[model samples]
Target: MSNDTAAQPAYFIAHITVDDVEGYRNYEKGFFPVLKPSGARFVTYDDNVTVLEGERESGRTIMIEFPSEEALMTWWDSPEYRELAKVRQAAVTTHSVTIVHSLPPR
Candidate 1:
């Protein structure tokens, strides 16, 4: 199966709380290269987040859209991302990553 082909579109969403701001910056810088080959596009990155309801709140919210689940997984499991994840792990105190599928266009 090709990287671009999948049953549906997939999105990666992350809610993060950074413990080391400077270290997080470094992680952001290193992330671009890791994302480039994965064909993932940034949907949003908001540091100033407002919690409307839930008990859980994060310092930042990020969303990335991918062509397919396969491509998303390929990127997530790739060596480049694995190495970069170390930087993210060190910088953030807490985070949640989720994968969601998009509904087909009408």
Candidate 2:
């Protein structure tokens, strides 16, 4: 068969750090459902990492993948989610939400 994965949807990765793991976990529990309505999914929320050439860490990291740019924007712009953003901001010291198209398909 020919390659069928060419038609799959892409993703946006959010490489972030949280100062308080407990607070972040609470935020995730609360906000995760909010994101699902906008087609956001947690591909990997890994805490274990090896920092080779980056700032020293004291917070947790997150990686979220959206289906597409439009979908990511949908969640980002949604009023419902916007209101809840403070929870995340307070929970984490800093966060870098980056959007990149997923390679191939997932």
Q: Each candidate's lDDT (Cα)?
A: 0.86, 0.67
State the lDDT of candidate 2 residue by residue for 1-99, as single tens digits. 124342344565455566677877777787867888866677776667678896755544566776666677778888878877777787776656666
Residue 47 in candidate 1, Cα distance off native in Å: 2.0
In candidate 2, how many Å is residue 59 off? 2.6
> Mind giving the per-residue lDDT tens digits that candidate 1 earns over 1-106?
4433475779999988999989999999989888989888989989877778777765888999987898899999999999989989999965689999876545
Measure candidate 2: CA RMSD: 5.1
Off by over 4 Å in 1: 1-7, 104-106
Model 2: lowest-lDDT 10 consecutive positions = 1-10
